[model samples]
Target: RTLTGHESVQPQTSREMLSSGHWLIPTIGGDVWLERPPPPMWWIGIVYTVTGVKASDSIARLAAVLAALPIILLTVGIAKRLFGKGVAVMAGLILATMHEFYSYAINPEADIFLCLIVTAVLALFVSMEFPHVRTTGAVAGSGKPSFFGTRPWPMAGFFLLLGATNWAKGLLFGTVMAAAPIVLYLLGRALQERSFHPLRPYLWCWGWLIAGAAALAWPVAVIGQYPEILQLWQEHYLGRLHRGYLREPWWYYAVQVPYVLLPWTLPALVGLLCSARAAWQHAGRERFICCWALSAPLLLSLADGKHHHYLLHCLGGWAILAAVGLAPLWGWLQDKLRLIPYSAALGAVAMALLAGTGGILWYSRIPGRWGTIVGAVVFISLATWVILTACQQHHLLRAFVGILAPILAAYWLWVPYQASYLDDYKEDLVFLRGAESLIPNDVPVLVQYDWTAPLETFWVLYHMRRPGVLIRDPWQAAEKTANGGQNSSTAYVLARRLDLPLYRRAGTVETVLESTRTRGEKNPDQRRVLYRIHFTQPLPPAPEDYLRVVRRTLW
Candidate 1:
């Protein structure tokens, strides 16, 4: 709402490129950087070119949302090819509802696009049936898909998608996608046949050609034009992947998976275990899906850099697995609750019991023993009644509602409240826009805070149309801007409330605007206070402000 649909706000990854107006060759701070490919930027650039419109969050995010469509279709097709139509629909539904997948579906980045490409690769991998069923249709895969001898077209398609994924983001996920299918096919074959077969000659030639061509296509073109970018690529890969940049604990995703998958976590877990069991018994499509799902995470866990979106490509596996359980669970629910009778009386009784449980939990002051008894009785009765009543209908729709009720409730209830703090960027952007009249457009607006939001910076520069810059220190800002130009005496500074004292100690400052915002989940006592202070002069030479000067040494 803050910016028009035509104007897009980019994430930090895209911010540097957007600011530098560099699309063909990626750069950071005006230097050549090829950590990410130019495919996404090129795509966005095409949107701008065709529409004759400027960048906006709407257009940038539209790319991601558009990428999601093919992913969903590919997922359904893959699931249908392997499991059948029912599982396909369930897989689509599971993916559509997943919080993590949908989150990136709206993000203005290449992550979701990469996810789409990787998923397409996996779908193609699943499409090519085993040699025993080479002439079979989608639903007739012979439980033993050989990666080496897959149909020529599907193998070509797999390589194409893998290449697209590499160009869409980086090679991290692309490498994983390319290797995963081959490894899974080999492993699945070994598990089922108890022997390894030699690579078929015709298939091996085509595979090698596709692999070599797809892997080198973009890099050859890029490096041929700009050889310096290759060094940046090597440094980035070595530093970030090997040395560690955004490294988290090895178990980071282990903890995050529960939150990421949300309501589907339990079902996915059940399905994963089932797939494992099925793989153990006889390696088949389930084993392939299981392998695809686990590959990226296992590789990523071994790597130093970790981000949640990196797991987006793997979510399709989780969704398909989760979908595998939905039909069986629904069937069991129908069979179990068919005789229970879904009546209004039963629902009312359940609701009343739940209400009583809530009341007891809230106000039951029965000291110790009586309170425990009351709590247990109320809780148990409520649980039993609700389960019975929910299952009474025995229909798929009712079962779905029962299964997803908590998640739906949380989305409808808790999300608005959580978003109040989580999406503080909107308010901050609006605040900056409102203060536009008070602050001069020409004077640089220094955002001095420890934690910064890239969206806010995008909003400030693009939406607010002001000279927005972020500095680590207010004193350093004062030092640089002081007597630097005509508007030097009136530059604006947005700092947290805690940092305001530091600014005051360093120089003369005037508060133009101030507002309090929730800091985050942690730091309840602290807040993200936006203090729009106007620095009048440079700071005096002093020891306390020496740290600020020292920080500027990098500049």
Candidate 2:
């Protein structure tokens, strides 16, 4: 953290903004710079407003807590339609109370938005079958969703919104999401004689709506902002997708699924295996949903570029399938393992009771934090009751993750306070801010490596500006140091602790900012070590970036 009070750490994107804090507005005659994600997906500004504290605190992540309710209600309703009310409630509760999703959601990340959107899409797909039935007493829709017409407009609208949001996040799940409606429409066509006829006109409408929505939200090609429409489109969407060439193992997402869907939800994988035959024989709505659920993650699984959050939108889809898989296994387990669920519950109850007792002893010392105690008592009592009353049929893993649900709920809520501790690194950020205050605001700054992340996001949004150049290789960094012309400017160096000695001896430099290591994370041998060393000499200003970053953020 390199800012005021160390409440949050500096991510590269946000840091770039800090250098240009003097200019928060883009004037008519000034240069126009399109940021990576204009008004980010997670609404970091909203997060900044709420906690009134920057850096990394649990307090700012209010989005997930508020979103949990809808995720629970919608998933439950879908599960009820597919399984039964009994499993529906359990499924909904399991998801609403899931610790895994909660962990990913509360971080100032885009997954929560994806999580809710995917869940809604999945639930809506399921509702296409039994439109008349109301699971959570929510509004009911027609059996066939009218995405193409007035009736289907809502679903179509949702798809468009979600589709753009997906693209904003590097088009993370774009291919998969785009394929869903096509597949659904295709399958629906095979069954029914006519569906959204005149494929040409229908495609026209689809293209217009999707494109219009994208143009409105995409910062790079903000419609009227530029006259070179096609050129800008290619650069923003197509170019961005190919630029970030970080390679990941192909099987990354597939391998993590077991862990993410842990304990109760893991066995649900069997349902996916069975769904193939089930879909072939039935071709029912459930079958359509089975395809929809797997499509997004399946595509992500195959992509050369991959990240864990890429398939987050599928969490709800996976949960629904997990419900289907578990509902059956839950029954079989009752007879076979008679005592397993109870064993797990007993273990949970004992743990909770012990915790509650511990709370009683510690409450005096930690008075205001009793929300912790109250939360523990409620969930533990609830779990004990479920264990005592959940007559025979229940998935053991489900029951375990379920019992631990309240504990995690308490943890997510309590841990945000510790974001303040996470903010400890912010002092370094403040030092950077202080440095910016001293230097001539108009002077261009050269960042020696690829500097982009949460910090950069903040700096950009706040309208801070600086000419941030990325000198990727050691040779590039070395070159600027070797040529100390008067035209040269300041360059920041990122290097490891061990290399600091070597760099200082070799070059004129100022300011070395080290990042607090992510717990258990160490500097990669290849990743330029994290020290932010400002070089005395800057490389010759390149025509493209020399003045642009500085002009935007400063006078």
Candidate 3:
């Protein structure tokens, strides 16, 4: 359950910011981390100060949890406006229970916040531009006045939210993601309506001028202090776009759609087809939702840098579309199965539950998991029964509950089970914790690792609870240990076991700790060893390496 990979960056940066009192600029290992903006770190810092809690994985993730609430509400609002209440509930539940959304909901990262801001922006834009059109009935001017009132105020709110996306990430990534769909929807609407009216407002809106100024405020303020950020921004943006950083084929996101949507994949696919058909036939909410759902993936695929989490911002559209797809399917099931007896339905449900329970007991042979198994089975059965009983007459909602309840229960059970028993990074954690216990607080730790694995070095430093220097070139190990001293001094160096001979050439190396792998494990790349290096004599200086300091911004 320890934070690994990019998850460690949030707390590490937050800790650095709080300790250094540098809220405007985020630093890691006493260096300005220009890779991301400060909003996520600021949110974590606020949570820590208000709750008096130390920075940990759970405390840091609380910020993500808070950010996800608005996304659900906004999705429900959009769905309710577009379809009816039934579809609204389905959309909300689909988004809340999605595997990808759940994964990012608990992760302390900026993607979820970006998704929140983007969803709000899109919802505000839709409410302003499109009247509410229900599937069963059409209402004229059903777009209710927002809290800021009608006309230019709501427009201003939309632009402001779009501008705030910069704070969520950096370099206008969110702005691009939010704007693409809006432009596409407007173009599509203009073509459908056979007029240039929809395009006019977007071009002449005064709110965009204010929003542009507001969006530039953060970058301008930061650049005024550290002008080098301009270069960093250029490199970061251009590198990701054209320089092949984490490059993937255009079909990468297309392939990941099913996995991202999980249980609703089939429904979403159906809904996407339905939306396309509806859009082709007439200009309505389907056209907008289709644009919203498809724009992110299509636009992101153009970038060389592609990640599965990058699509998180567009999940609301997919969720609503899935609801749209489910409504008709639900109606068909109701009509076809109406003649079935309640006793037969209950019997089938019981049999399916029993089969699932048997599989769980059979497969999960881990010790001390019986309690979770029993608890899950009991809770799922009781909850399913209550839901079925309450909505027995309404076949559509009952069917949804039947499909959704078990998945939710299983997810609830899996969290504790995975946290307690499943740890893929246990070897690294064990080695780091062992090194922390063996090494003295005053003794500086020099992590001698190849420049390729920044996450490993970051994991060590974050858990070690001290700033350490990185010696990417093994030849500099002795020079680092000497610390410009001719007298005797000791420092611990962490290196792979395979690279022990290289460090032994630098100084007197004594193995202090070693990471152990499970039996039959064939991967030798991760076998790390901590060595206590003693410097009796000064060593010659080596040429500077590009990665001498521990940089946490690589990810």
TM-score of each: 0.68, 0.59, 0.81
In candidate 1, stretches whose alpha carbon ends up further than 4 angstroms from where it belongs are 1-21, 25-35, 44-61, 130-154, 190-259, 297-310, 338-422, 442-490, 493-511, 518-555
RMSD list, candidates in order = 7.6, 9.5, 5.3
lDDT of model 2 at position 449: 25
TM-score of 3: 0.81
Give the lDDT of residue 327 in candidate 1: 58
Clashing pairs in 1: 7-56, 8-55, 8-56, 8-57, 9-57
What residue runs in model 3 are displaced by over 4 Å at the alpha carbon?
131-151, 204-206, 221-236, 242-244, 335-393, 444-450, 465-488, 498-506, 518-522, 545-555
lDDT of 1 by residue, 245-315 (tens): 88788998887766778668877887887778765565577766777778777777887888777778788
For candidate 2, lDDT tens digit of each residue in 99-143?
466565554344554556556655654564345443321222423
For residue 474, give model 1's deviation from the true position in Å.
Answer: 8.1
List lDDT for all candidates, in order. Answer: 0.61, 0.48, 0.73
lDDT of 3 by residue, 1-555 (tens): 667666777777787788889888876555566777888888888888888965667777787788888899999998887887889999999999999999888877788888888999888877766555464212223334333334566766887888888887886899988898888877876786786666655553456766787688888888887787877888878988999988999899999877898878877888898778777666578887888888988999999999888888888999998988875655655555555667434744785589566758675674456665556566656665554443344666777877787678778777877877776577777778788778776666677644445555555556665566666554555556566354336667877766676555556778888888621235765477788876436543544543344322333
